[model samples]
Target chain A: MKKLILSTAALALVAGFASADVVRMGTEGAYAPWNFVNDAGEIDGFERELGDELCKRANLTCEWVKNDWDSIIPNLVSGNYDTIIAGMSVTAERDEVIDFTQAYTPPDPSAFAALDAGLDVEGGVIAAQAATIQAAFIAEKGWTLIEFATPEETVAAVRNGEADAVLADKSFLDTVVGSDGLVLLERTEMIGGGVGMGVRESDQELRATFDAAIQSMKDDGTLNTLIAKWEVSSQW
Target chain B: MFSYCTDPEALEGLAWLSCYLTTGKHMGLYISVVTVLVLLAITAPVALAFGFAGATAARSKFLPLRWLGKGYTSIVRGVPDIAFFMFFVIALDQGFEWLRHQVKCPDWPDAIRQGNDFVVCTAAKLPLSASPQWLHETYAFFLAVLTFAIVFGAFAANVLFGAMRAVPRPQLETAEAYGMTRRQTFWRILVPQMWVYALPGLSNLWMVLIKATPLLFLLGVEDIVYWARELGGTKNARFTDYPHGDWRMWYFFALLVFYLSFTKVSEVVLERIMKRLTHGQATSGGEAQRRANA
Candidate 1:
């Protein structure tokens, strides 16, 4: 019985090694245009479509998992999911933690959205998503930065008067400013490197697969088409 | 919603308001209230059962059992409830995955915990990475429930232990005099009598549990608070049919009313239960009732 149990366990271990084909893609499904959860409770939006296309092109079976933005990178390293297809900007600070594919979308200006234009952008309380380039920029400028876990919360902070303004991607604020008693400030500055898919540093082969897939899309103009369709950022 | 709600921006006043409330995201917010209620409904009885076992174990003649129950009740008391909720969920999740890893992959070589990363083999992944969306959600919800039950169970056990002791010794003596066995005496006398003493603490715990439901956001469960934040955020004209300003305060106010009414309803029910349990008992409430009747 002991020998049979040992052999059975060995077989199971072998079976476990054989089923490693599927790549789990994690995204903060709360971010719209980039990625968001639809009314049907499925992951929808730009990255969802792009991720599926990339997966098909790369010939890798992929599944999407929704995770909170704050812990997304940590969870990736911890093996919760294999790749982060969230709207994560390639940054030197983030590069220390995980590897990134080539830019899927080029760097876009991060704009300030406020109730009115005149609020002192430098001195006034500003909200940004935690761990984003905007938050780092705000901190460097010596402004009071109230960081939130998700991008939406940063905008919510501005709307609720918790902050004077919010600094986020222009593409995201473009959808928010006109109707929500908010107006985008004129002095938008480009921040961070282009957005890319993040993978664990150990997963070089997986990173190469996605890197090639992104390159193919870029070459065929499909990447630019999706960017325009989603109105994500300024096209590459 | 009116038929004219098809053109939301064109509609104004009460018509627009009605249409706004019936939006799909608003419906998600409404359903989240059911989620909180379901969590409470499932957790309360499970916590109570855990509490009963803990209290029984604490009172046992066996030293190890007594220590275990004592440790369970006291250890959680020192940590803040939120801290316990946050810590226990991750710990329990990792614990389950590690056990599964050991069983499923005997020959797999790497240490499961390498620095900060929990490197489990793919097959050991809880809910197994290949499971459906519902299974993933169900697994997360199940973990949340267990974490809640474990934390609240300790508090419930503390209340029950005191309640068990508060049961008069003479009542047990009377049962013994009637030729009852120890188990029979405990069931017929002690357990029945302990309820009246336990009611106040248990009701307070229920209220705490209700308030703590908001922490489900931390657990990554989209509870009412999450929905309130999501749906109440500024939705510009480009994003939604019923574009709104920061209406989070209003959504939160609605949640406030929901919780207040829920607590009010709970208070009335608990009062009736207390009255029922106190009836014809040796307590002051029972004595007052007897005097009033006489």
Candidate 2:
């Protein structure tokens, strides 16, 4: 038992001093702008490319894996993935369990889209998934809110004109909202907390490297171009 | 420190209630219940009907037709049911368009099934592109119902065909001797007498059908499973009037109760049916009935 404990302590000490090398990244392959697998079976999108760039800048070898939106976090917690580059909105609730890097993409809460062209939804209030700061923003705006199984359904409701608009992340709005005739109509008055690069709580060194990666990407003007690529129809 | 609870700190009565009810996902959770019932309600009858036809065809005098029915029942039974559910719907939808493609969009030259993708003209799209969200949902449900019916029907057919043959050949022959035609004897003797034997198999089929309702979520029906996940997902306290932690376990527990209640109700109905079917027949159930109540 003494030897086992000593070996474990030695391993921990080694891990602490060892350079950050290989990192496993998690992503929900559903959302288009963030990360989605295309017809050619290649993961393509802003998040996908950005993660590669971040790894390169951080001097780390990276591996990407697709997971369902629901299982993404549990898998991360279970040590399946070291980082999540999925457009995961960092909330205080999430921070309690897992730490996040500095904001890579600013919050732009979702806007409404409608089936009817002249539906006059400019000032109508809305609701998004509960527990989200978006829900609080909804109450502040005094809008009726609805939750759906997927963003696809929420957008479907807007397309069906069930609600005046959907409240969601700006990046989500960019990916989900269509241009046929629907429009954002309005943006929330205050900016909600933005999405950030996620890492396991113990991976502070990795998080620091990710923060540096973000700064490098921003300086190179590559981040702006990547944002432009994903932001097909920006809400903000 | 806040545990996974739907209701935490309360501000007021109505305010708390409103927050509790409108946590946003409640509506979808509620709708999923209807979707499951609707899928089951339609699919069960269609499956039963298809099973009846398939069983009859398997017993038919025509060699090729009998082989087709036999092949359908056996081949489907061997494969994973979910695969049939996934592939059959897409195949069936494309099959519908292929028929329509041959007639409607014949001039447009493109192979309908290209490798893994099936593409038809925009005009040939099932439930036309301009249809509403509810219509898309309905169309998807229609496809699911068809898929469930086709798959479950095959199983039911195998059960029913055995039950049909289990009816005494002597009884059928006696009916024929009485100057009754084959159709008349089938209805008057074979169909009536086959019930006692078929009841056991059919009751088992009914239980399976009830359990299979969860598969609707896999088909994108947004049923109870979808709602449970959506509503159960944790929301950050940073954004809501009434914030809570992950309550997915409780949501799943509620779903378990719903399914159990559904199963209990079906069991009662099937029991009642079994009693009714056993009345005044040559079988042991009928014989016991005569001795007990006579």
Candidate 1 is graded, for docking, as: acceptable
Q: Compute fnat per model.
A: 0.22, 0.00
TM-score between model 1 and native: 0.89
Task: Work out candidate 2's RMSD over C-alphas.
Answer: 21.3
- List pairs with backbone clashes in candidate 1: none
Q: Report the TM-score of chain B alone for all candidates.
A: 0.94, 0.89
Looking at model 2 chain A, which ten-residue stretch has the lowest summed lDDT? A1-10
What is the C-alpha lDDT profile of model 2 across A212-233, one tens digit per residue?
A: 9998877787787778776722
Error (Å) of candidate 1 at residue A35 is 2.4
For candidate 1, write residues A5-106 as lDDT tens digits: 354355434444444577889998777778876544467889999999999999988888877787788778777688999899999999988889999999
TM-score of each: 0.89, 0.56
